[model samples]
Structures are given as C-alpha cells and as structure tokens.
Target: MSTIEQPRPATSPSADWWRQAVVYQIYPRSFADLDGNGIGDLRGVTSRVPYLRELGVDAVWLSPFYPSALADGGYDVDDYRDVDPRIGTLADFDEMTAALHAAGIRVIVDIVPNHSSDRHAFFRAALAAPAGSPERDRYIFRDGLGENGELPPADWTAAFGGPAWEPVGDGQWYLHTFAREQPDFNWDHPDVREEFLTTLRFWSDRGVDGFRVDVAHLLLKDLPETLPSRAELAAMDRTSGTHPLEDRDEVQDVYATWREVFDSYDPPRIAVAEAWVATPERRARYAAPTSLGQAFNFDLLTADFDAGQFRRIVTENLAQSAAAGSSSTWVLSNHDVTRHATRYGLPPLAGREGKQGVEWMLAGAPADGVDRELGARRARAATLFLLGLPGSTYLYQGEELGLPEVGDLPGDRRQDPAYHRSLDQGTWTYDGLGRDGCRVPLPWRASGASLGFGEGAEPQPPHLPQPDWFAEYAVEVEDGDPDSSLTLYREALRLRRELQAAETLEWVETGSEDVLRFRRPNGWEVVTNFGGEPAELPAGRVVLASRRLDGTLPGATTVWLAP
Candidate 1:
C-alpha cells in the first residue's frame, strides 16, 4: 500500500502545478560560493533558492553533496548520510532543504547506489576481509579466476580507459566500471541492496523530494563470459560502457525495489534514471508505475539536425512509453557531458572534434558571423527547440545564458577525470576543453572578479569572459525586457503553465522538411526550422521564438504558435 498521502483534488498538478514545470539542475560545486572559498556549497545553494523560484523552476536537482573523495566529482561516495566537508555539514543540508521547501521548490539529490569510493568504510572492510568472507561477498571478489590465475575477471574494460577488473590481492579481483578508486557495488548481494535502501530512506526522511539516480543502469552486468566483445568494449572505453551497464534486465528489478521503498514517503517522491541507452523497450520498463518516474532519452542527445530525424526520436520515445504504459521526462544536457551549445548545430570545439561535420554544425555556429548575431541566433534556436519539446525538460546550469565550452583550462589545471584518463591512455592530444567549458561555475553577477560567483576575488577569473550583453540577456536584466532570451524563457514557461498546455503533448503534422510542427494537448503548436534558411510558420500568436518569428524563422530556429 502506498504511504504517500493523496493530495486534495484541488492540490493536484493535473489541476495546477506540473504542466509546464521546469527543473533547474545545480552542480553545487559551480553554482555559487558561500565561504569565500572557490567552491559552491549548500549555503550558497540555499541563498539562491529564490532565484530558482524566480526563474520559474518548480524543482531543483542538487547534484551529490555526500561525503566523497571528490574523485569523479563526488560520484565516489565515502558516506551517504553526511554532507561533504568541502560542501558543508549535514546541518547545512537540513537548512537548504528547509529553505527550498519554504520557497515551493522541490529538492532532488543525486544518489549513487551502483558504486562507492574505495575510501568508503564498507570497501575498506571488504578489502581487509579474506576472500569468500561474509564482508568480501558484499563486493565482487573472486579468487583463482584469471589466466595463470594472474589476470583480471574476464576481459571487461573500464569506462575510464582500462580493464574493469583490478586485483585486490589474495589472488582476488574486483570490478570498477569507472575509476579504480571507485569500486562497483555487488547489487546481486542482499546486503548491498539493504544498505542502499537505508541510504535512500535517510534522505527521504530528511525531506528530499526525489533523486536523480546516478548511472542507475549500472547495478548489474553479465558474469564476465557473456559480456560485450573486446572491440565493442574498447570503443566505449571512455563512456558508461566498458562493462554492460545499461539496458540490462536486472536494472528493472533494482528500480522496483527502490520504488517500493520510496512509496512509503509522503507527498509521493520521484526517481529519475540517467539512462543513455537506445533500448527504449528496456528504458520504458524502468518507468513502470512501481519504478522510476523518469528516465533520460539519449535519442535527442544523439539526434541529427533533420526534421525526419527529430520526429523519429521524439515519436519513438512516445511510442516506447505507450507500449510500456509509462510516462516520460526529457533532458537537454546534464553535468556529465559537453554542453548542448557545443553538441548540436555548433562548430567543432573540444570533445566533439574528429566526429563528423554534422555534430559540429548541430552544436556549433553557422559559417556566417557577420557579427556575434550568428552565435546569439544559434543559442536562441537551440533554446527554442529545447523548450518547445514535450515532457519535463532539464536545464543544465548556465545553459540558459548560451554559454559555450571552456577552451582555456591548462592541462595541469583541468578538473575533469576524462582529461586525466585520456592523458594516461597516451591519448594526450585530446584537449581538456569539451564538457568542462559548460561545467564551469555560473557567472551570477559581473561586478567583480569571479563574476560574483565567489566572495571577494577568485584565484582564477570566470571561465570565458562574462557575456557583456548579459545586461540584456541576464535574468535580473530581462525581467523587464520582453525580447531577451531569458525573458523569452520566462514567457515560454508561463505559457506552458497555462492549464491546457500542461497536459500531454502530441505530434500533429510535419509538412516542411525544414519546418516541424507538434501540437500541445491544449491546442498550441510548437514549430521549428532546423535548416540554415528561412521557413514559414502557420500564422498564430507567437508565444516563444527562436528569433521572434514575425514571418519566417531563420535557419535553425523555433517558434510556438497558439490560436
């Protein structure tokens, strides 16, 4: 039986809240500075609760604040119940939760149930115990399993560029999907499942409204022999591949277990999966009413800039949901990869080079930049495409400002683990520029050094000089400027909130190869032109625009039409 209290009929989003709700994801380390330290913490986040509310987001996904070694940027948790010292103490988290709740914004924290940092006490105990010992069984420990009994378990590779298996002595080997310092948890073990359940309860009891499950599909894998090919494994040596982490049948079981536990809480919490798989069948299974409320659709992440391609991606997702009897949630980008600005319809930057010209053109700028208008126009076009889509959209930090990837971090100063991995693998030619650029701290104000993201001045200046036009593009500056991108977002959000638009979305007609159209259940039309040429739109009151579509939207643009 669900312990969640059913809200009064009038309290439901079907009547009010959800419809066009926006979720702003805050990578705490880069959101704001509270202690004069360059790092952003819970207090800094707490101070900005109102800003999120003002931005019209109904929820805020606070990335992991758990105690960690900072390896893999806090995904390697040393403890789950406490806040990291660098971020703050548990008390700060309590205050942050209270503050966000008071302001009407729900809080979602990242939960890493798939693995833990090697420094974690549980891992320490497992290491100290003998092979086959009760504690050792909590992890994937096996003796006498390698060739000459000297190699790792099977030939699985690590997502961080090496063998997934590492020796733990005693002739035993352990698995690590990512960094060696982070050991994968044995979800097959009953104890592992129990411990994670307790961790989930600890946060929910403390008022976390939901969780953005970290690499949720990594809970299980085939037993060495049945794993993907060495060639296939090597190709994904740098992704959440290496071992088969996702679209695995066993992952659904984990979601079912967590869902049962979550249902015991009040207000009915939500769970989201960071699934980057194309197996929509398996993806949908995780969204069963008894499982997670949301799972990311990587189709858009891999989508090409064509009307047919876009339609297929969106339609396939919707069909998958209907077939599986599940609801859907959408996202543009998160903290893990390169920013969308550099991912689609843009030029080759860092992580995207050596791929294809299309990838650059998708996230890169058009050849013509008579002025900065080309970049600005591309930014608006991307934003329109993002906002005009159906389902819940995740706004990565600083993406609303059309910020590009940071191209200036010195090799020594680079903070991403991917860069270090590339260097270790002798693939040092790869630049430290990709996603790192989009992950830099949010430039809150441009008055002083660090751009007001920290107290006084930062040891380093803000990444990419602050956009001077922010005087016109910023949230503070655009509340009054109806034509600003920030203002446009605000208006789009408001229009989406209008009762009729909050329901499900449906694709109506996509006539023009360059122009695509979809209808909101509320009778609003969302249209776009991905081509680099002007395209016509059905005449209607324009609520959102890639360039204020008065007649034709320029190449790579979007506009919302309402009768």
Candidate 2:
C-alpha cells in the first residue's frame, strides 16, 4: 500500500547475476502469517523482505501461490494467472514483488506447467465434453484397455503412488503423473503451448525476475509403442538414460519457446528447471543457452556424506555445467523430500538408488543410530562446502535455522498426497512418505501462539503443528547467538557476495583421503575434514569456519580461507 523503490534490473553487462547468486526459497504457506489466519500469505512474505536482504541473498524463489485445490500442495493449479485466496490476491503479489525489489532482491515464482488442477476451467470443460471433442483434447484422456473399459489404459504408476490413470466414466481415463486431482496437460496441443507462453508474459510484465519451472522434465510423454511399464521403468538406472514419460527430447522445444519470452524483456528474465533426469549430460540439456537458464543439480542431495562421494558429484556437476555453457544450480533440500539436517544424521545406506534412499531415511528410528547433534554439525559443514562451490546455491525455507525433518507427524495433520497414496497401497503408516515434515511453519520467536508466525486477536495455529523442540531453534534465539546456524548462514552469504568469484573450481588435494579441499578463481580456498581427526588448514588466513578452529580444522567441519 505504501510507495517503495523498485529493484534494479537483474541483468548485468559483464556477468549473469544468477551464475553465482544465492537464492532463498520461501514456501509461502509456511513462511509467515500476517492476518493470523494461521496460513502464510503474500503480505507475510512482503514483510520479510528486510530479513532476506539482511541475509544477503540476491533473489527469493517463492513456491506456487496460484489458485489451487491445495491438492499436491498447490502444484495442481486451477488458475495460473490468479493467486490462491488462501495466499493473497494479485494486488498483494504486486506489493510483495515491489517490496522485495525495494530490498534489492529479485523474485522467482514457481511455474507448474506439467499439469493443471482437475478443477481448472479447461479440465472441467474437458470432462463435460464428449470423448472425441476438441475440449477433451486439452488433457491426456484415453479409452480404456478392457472391452468393458474397466482397466486403465496404461501400466504407469503415479509418482506419489497407485495407478497414474484415473477412471472418469464412459470408458475414459485421464493421466495424472501425480495425484488424481492433477490432470496432465497435452503438451502436443497447440493451444496448451500458447497458453503457457501467455502465462510467462503475464508475470514478466508484472516485474517478476524469473521462474522456477515445476516438473520441467515431464511435459512430454514418449510414443505409445515405446512406453514402458512402471515396474520396468523403476528398475532402470536413471543416471544411465532417460525414462519414457520423463525428460523426453520433445520437452526442449517447449523450453526454447519459453526462453524466447524471457529474452524479450529489457533485462532478460531467467528460469530454473526442476528436471530430475538421468545423467548429468541429460540434465545439462535443460540449461542449454536456448532453453532454461539452469537445472537443479540434485546429486549432492543424495550423495553420501563421504568425501569421495561429494568430490565425485561436485566434479561431475561442474563438468556438466561447462559442457552446457551454463552455471549449475546446487541445492540440499526442498519441499518434496527430507531435510538435509535429519538426513545427514542417519547412517549412510549403501546400494540404495532413486527414492529408496529417502525411504531408508524416513524408516529409520531416532534411537537406531540416528544422531541429531551429528546431523546438525554435518549440515553446517555441508552448508559451507556448498556455498563455496562455483555456481548458484538454493537455501530452502527454515534451513538457515538448522531445522530438521519432523518424521513423526500425526496422520490427521498429514496433507501430502504421498501419505494418502501410501495408505491406498495398504501401508498403515505414511511416516516418511509424506512431505508435511519439512513444510512446517518456521519458528520466528522462541515463544508465541504460533512461534511469532502470525499476528491476530486469537492465537492462530500453524497449518501443521511445530514440535516441542522447535523453540530451541527459533530465529530469535539463533539470531542473538553468534555461533548459531542462522548467524553462520548470514556470515557465509555475506562473504560469498564479497568474494564474487568467477565460475570456476579447482581441486586442492589434501594428503588425507577424508579431507576435501578446493580453491575458487577469486583466490578463496575451502577445506572440509570428513575424517575423525583434525586436518591442517591450507596455507592461508581463515576467513570463516563452520565450527571453531584451532591450528587445525576439526572433523566434520569446513572453513573458508583467503590467500
């Protein structure tokens, strides 16, 4: 409602700001609550612009705030152009964007292009129209395989679980890669493609800095004859090749068109694809010059905490970025999976692939070899190591406060479709499968009705309950402590901005195999000791350390040094 200065354009003549920018991810529903209705909204996010600016991030990537049925946590969009009433209105979004820009931070909103909420106008029209009508062509509607049409058209399973196809009467079934409420759009349709381009322009015209493309790799499906069963597809190695319905070659053409719209702006807008494809080479294609600017490199998220594993993933990711002539985007956690703090604390599980690793983490008992202290320590070190890397990095909401995954969420409070889907498969408990844990509202104050997340006459409860231990990790508590995780993040980000290193990484070998060391083009060196013993620091002055350092760096610690 008040006048605010607009942020400078994101583009720079000499360098791409995104190449090494630190982007903070804000999950709106859980970020902060202004009206105290217990849900976070656009105005809530607007009020936090100063907090982000103080944290020293170049941009803030807000998850979807569009009108939705809340199925799949707003991923199933009923309308992409309008904001969900629960979040705020278009005016609120403009206010938030202006406030962020005034704080000198760019804005990147999530764009879910893979599917639309079944309640969407287009989907609703498709459902009411005759099977062969043009209206029905907007989505992936097909005839049943059985004579009576009782059987699903394909053997594909949904990513959340259960059958990917849901029956919709008249021997017709619609494809939904996620929940049944989310119907996959037919990318092959000329109208569908044009609609998304219009959506892109709508936001860019409103001053959005960029977009984080949801399910970026899942726009196109393989030819019917080449499609494989869910079982066989699951067994295949993702790092070796592509999947039938995921990351198909046709997806690139869609991004190329989106890229054209981005380039039309004065300071070209950017996009980062959430493409979880197989192989770094395949992933690199998504970040090609004519496609999206960046694709999330998630190898580090699943890599073992071992030094060797980290080195291999880092090297491969850097190589992939070089091949594509684009800077890689590194991330440790997001809304879809377990938080890194709890994950790093668990014992490494060998021979696990794909979602199996996440399952193993979720199934593990707190008393069964899981150490929260160790996990926190490793997470801090991991943060320093990741921030020191060559390219841009993303920090999930509440990660800066050293938040751990709440694995023991009550079944009644569980909202993720994965949890309900697991129940559908006859699993009694959906403990780890659901993503409600990491989606909990942040603890801003040590004590409050909702931990200072909301302000209303009545104490507004968070969408999900915060654990009893959350108070200890509250922002107010950590903000006052110099050694707190929040402080560590703030300092690390400040130094990263100061260094402004070129996009290059060179490994510096330490004699100990457990110690990983590397130097950046800005004459900054980073060292991490994964061994049980201390390792001598590289020849330089220590600028920042994840933990207190004496003459040597302690095990499970990292330090940034200046030559």
By TM-score, who's the top model here? 2
The residue-by-residue lDDT of candidate 1 on 1-563, one tens digit each, is 01212211222322123324478889888887777577788998988776665565677898888888776778899998888898799899999988877776778899988789998888999998887788877777655465555866567667766677889767888878888888988887898888889988999999887888888777886566444556775465333233455556667778888888887766667787876664676677666677786776766655555677777787787777656555456666677665565555344233344534333322322223112455556656656665666666788877766655444445565666666775576442223333454566766664456666776434444433333433333344444566666566655665655533543567666566777788876677878787777876667788667665546677878777775
Q: What's the true lDDT of residue 546 in model 1? A: 62
**Candidate 1: misplaced stretches above 4 Å?**
1-20, 144-150, 222-246, 345-376, 427-434, 456-481, 499-503, 506-510
**Candidate 1: residue 241 lDDT (0-100):** 35
**For candidate 2, lDDT tens digit of each residue in 1-563?**
11223333433432277888899999999999988988899999988877777777888999989988798888989998999998799999999998888777889999999999999999999988999889889898888888888898879878778888999989989999889999999998898998899999999999998999997988986546435566787786655334567787778888999989999997888899988876678889888989998899888877767899999988888888989989988899888767889888876857544555455435533434468889888999999999999999999999999999886667788789888887787542233358888898999888878988887778579998887788888888988588999889988987887776788888987888999999988789999998768888777889899988888888899999986
Per model, state how many residue pairs clash. Answer: 16, 0
